[model samples]
Target chain A: MFWQVFLFRVALVAALVIPTPFFLTQAHADENLWGYVYGTDTLPAGANEIYLWTTSRNQKGKGNYRAWDTQLEFEHGFTDRFQASLYLNGRSHQISGGALAEDPDRRLHRGLEFDGFNVEFKYNVLSVYKDLFGLSLYIEPEYQRIDKISGERVNGFGLESKLILQKNFFDDQLALAYNLTLEPEWKKFQATGERERELELEHTVGVSYRFLPHWFAGVEGRYHAVYPEFKKRESDAYFLGPNIHYAAERWWFTFTFLPQVSGNPRIAGRNSNGRQLSENERYEYRFKIAFNF
Target chain B: MGLLSNFDQLTCALSLSSVRRIYQAGDLADDLVKCRLVVLRIKIGFPRQGVIMRTAQWIWLPAACLPVAAISIPAYAATYLTVEQAQQTIFPGEKLAPANIMLTNEQAREIERRSDANVRRKDIKLWKVANGGYFIVDEVVGKHEFITYAVGLNADGTVKQIEIMTYRESYGYEVRNADWRAQLAGKNAAAPLKLNKDIKNISGATLSCRHIADGVKRILATYEIALK
Candidate 1:
């Protein structure tokens, strides 16, 4: 029981610091600023808005982890049909273990990480007949900074881009959207205790559906290929998750789960004989609460 | 795999098909802590369960049933617009006495809609007495306006008072700004009001003075039918 709590805290901390700005931006896009008027199903022109969010996650295991995310988001409507936004996401994670870790004395570890907080501009390239359905293409350029994390620490700029396809049916009763992004990451890691630059690649695909007002559900999958500064080692990671959201009158909540779909160990250095070490992976059940003005 | 284990836990929380399937799932008693997390998500995710559409109908149903709700929501109820009754009660075309009447539901709705659209003078309202006296109700000044020395009938269809309310005119000088309202003293159904040159119209404030005189004239028409 104690171990599960520890794992929950650790997983939450990592998810919170991921700098996933698009999630926070999308939440405010359709909400109204004035209480009387209903917000639109499509982004309104010349509309500028702000949002703040906090997210946490936990894993069901011998250890538990908790994470926190805080972000300030700004979006501007260039035209009635086009809009752009910038989001700044920062987060920290805390991990504790009762028995989840092989090292029983590993009581706690805290680390802060930030993702690519990019300025993304979106244009409504085309609208279907009667503007019933539309397609939007957006490009985001970002700089990611990482302060603490073993083997993953880097201070480098990255470019993340997304193409979204959206459709509205049943007279706006339902909305289905698909989002795809290719996030390129580079970091300066230390080999032989000396700084070295390493390159990484990530691809993400997500689908969201709003079956009811103020409520939406989605699923996302990510493939991360992590290469070391030196050619001696190789590792890869995978995450797939279900995300659910509810929002009403200045309040929003979200929950998600990513159980770490794949983690294959790397072959150790030539000198070690048949000994293995299990690396840390991000496996979490997450929750988020947000308020907007 | 780690993912498979978490998936199993989620399925256990979401699937309620069989009691045995839930309890017999491995470590049900032990993994109750994990199960609690799943339940929290389900509970907070009420909006995703299509509750918004259901709640919208519920809240709008009661309000639309009140007055112009039919015009707003389109289904639950409609306004009672008896045009003939309104014609007789609000604007009776009787020669002897004009109908001084209260507003009908449709008229009230029109006033509200117009006021909202105008935004500048949203505080305007119209009031009616039981008997048949219609007064220009200006809540802005916290007072009522009627013809000078004019008798207002009560709700029971009897003459209530004979008072000179005001005679402020905005246009002409036939009737001075201060004395224009004094012309209607002691006027009743027995003495029809003549708000023309014979009666006296303010020179620059003619339009305003005429409004007061015409207002009294219209009220007399309402009184004729309401009293009968």
Candidate 2:
């Protein structure tokens, strides 16, 4: 157990620092400029990068709640216009005595576990400099062995696709981005032997300013609408947040804090402060770092 | 043996500057001759035997082959132009007197303020043309590389010509197109000089275009405030 923790830490640190020779080049554009919003830039041909992200979901209106979701990603550019990535995701949550867990039989959950794997691809269709604006199409398929929220054993599959758009102004110091995403997921719960399907419609808008050299400050807003079993609307949630980003020659970090501003959830019998606590957390904090070679 | 002796010096030349300088200034015959020279030296150093020369057969051979391999990589990333060549190409039959000037922080700040572009360096490499214009060598951060380019300004502060001096890019080669660069000509400080407005944009080259456009704008602003 100690070695597992130690080796994991060491491997992450080594990944962040070992590729010093990549110092000759700058971070590729495909490196996420925002925490949640997608940028339309693709990596140069033959370039590769590694990304690690940790997001903390906090508060659920009742009881103590905190969950950490971590994802380690490896991305590569096959061509100047196309890029792909693989992600390994893990989650640890402590939700005690709350409706945060959808199943009453699993109200309290704890412990960390490997949860999911995902593959993503991006194709650039237009360049912000060469064309009127930038555009890219993205597709990702994810497989989950454990539930992210309830910490229950399950088999889940999801396909998420997005259309990313970007436009820069003020000498490219200020950038605006929008992403439209559609995701559908299927899950079979081991505890109840129940099957569920969900379709989520999401959109994000972001604007960032390069406040200082290698540093950026921005705000992003996200809206999510979900339908269970592809039926009527089951929930509505919106989040708004601020993010700060700093990028060096070989590495970059982006931190964002998003709080649920409004939502209507069916779980927990009621909504808290007009915010959905059953389906989403009261606030989420994410820190992402990426290294390129 | 000669190749082994020159081996130490050969690896040092692998530095990007020296390698690119050699590759840019060399022709096919010249570059291949260097490659073959290393190979021939190693060939001579190998000892001939009667039956099977297996003792030192592959040993030390790879070390000698290193330089030969390095020399064969064509200069695809970085390309350059000498300052003299740039001056002559921009202004033929005109004498350019070296009039390099250093910008004070205040002047640089003012240029940045007027152009709305950040100033990374304050030292400007400038020359005064015998004709009524000026030539300035400048560099801007491309999408991933530092693009060194030269700009000529007419006496009235309008751009005369722009020449890329040193270009290194993994992608976004469209910025090097003559037509893309030519659009910046005849523009002055007052021009919008913004991407997709006064100057057109090329896909996959947005940052390159923005930085180069901002660079030209900064130079024009410099001319308006300091040089004028």
TM-score to native of every candidate shown: 0.39, 0.67
Question: Taking the tens digit of each residue's C-alpha lDDT, what string does model 2 give over A56-159?
Answer: 78787777676777677889889878999998776666666654545444454443346678999999998765567889999999999777667677999999
Q: DockQ scores for all the models shown?
A: 0.02, 0.04
Backbone clashes in candidate 1 total: 55
Instruction: Give stretches of model 1 more than 4 Å off.
Output: A1-42, A55-69, A95-108, A111-117, A127-133, A147-153, A189-213, A218-238, A249-252, A263-282, A285-293, B1-228
Give the per-residue Cα lDDT of candidate 1 at A91.
48
What tens-digit string does per-residue lDDT give for candidate 1 at A1-293? 33432343333323332323222221124332211111223344544555444343343234554444434456676664566777765545444564223344434443333443668677766442124455667666766543222213356565666665655443232444545555554555433343544444455554455645456677766555545653433555566788766654323455566545765453333111221113324554444443322
Best by lDDT: 2
In candidate 1, residue B201 scores what lDDT? 46
Against the true structure, whose TM-score is highest?
A: 2
